[model samples]
Target: MSGDRKEVVKLLAEFSTIGMSVAFSIFIGVGIGYFLDHKVFAGRTSPWLTLIFLGFGVAAAFKNLYLMSRRKDL
Candidate 1:
């Protein structure tokens, strides 16, 4: 019963962190993209880099989730 309870707690922690991980990943990607667009690209293109990197961030988040769920030691 103690083991089961530990597992439940672990699962709760994991599930709670999933949302935050995804959000932070996307935010970081967007931040980088925004920097690149304004500071690096400089009016050559606006919003395109941000959009592209945001998509990449979303993909990376899902990939993290996929790998996490696949891990047996989780």
Candidate 2:
């Protein structure tokens, strides 16, 4: 295979790994937050917990997009 093609493949693999790690971390964080909200909140306001998850989710998405944008040449 050509050198450029090899580099592209390598970049893609790295990007996918990073993206998947972020996604998984987000999933785990949200899951734990939900459980805590359910178990600890009981009757109290939950907007803070919701907002926390929202912020993390958005941050994860933006990070993934940023990483993807960095490899435009690939």
Candidate 3:
């Protein structure tokens, strides 16, 4: 019983991180794009890089979701 409870708790903890992981992934992507566009290109690229990176971020988030859903433990 104790072992089962422990496993449940561990799994719950892992599941709870999904949201944070997704958000952080997106934020990091946007941050990188913003840095590149503004700092590296000096406003020449403007919103294009930001939008492109945002799409990448969203794709990454979905990929994370897909992987999580496919977890055997779940």
**Candidate 1 per-residue C-alpha lDDT over 2-57 given as tens digits, one digit per residue, 9 for 90 to 100:** 99899999889878988899999899889888888899999577899989989888
**Candidate 1's TM-score:** 0.75
After superposition, the stretches of candidate 3 with alpha carbons farther than 4 Å from their true spots are: none
**TM-score for each predicted model, relative to the true structure:** 0.75, 0.54, 0.90
**Alpha-carbon error at 41 in model 3, in Å?**
0.8
Give per-candidate clash totals.
Answer: 0, 0, 0
What's the lDDT of the predicted structure labeled candidate 1?
A: 0.88
Which tens-of-lDDT digit does each residue in 16-69 have in candidate 2?
Answer: 777677777678667656765777886264656756875686687677778777
How many angstroms is residue 64 displaced in model 3 relative to the true structure, after the best TM-score fit?
0.9
lDDT of 3 at 6: 94
For lDDT, the strongest prediction is 3
Question: Each model's C-alpha lDDT?
Answer: 0.88, 0.72, 0.92
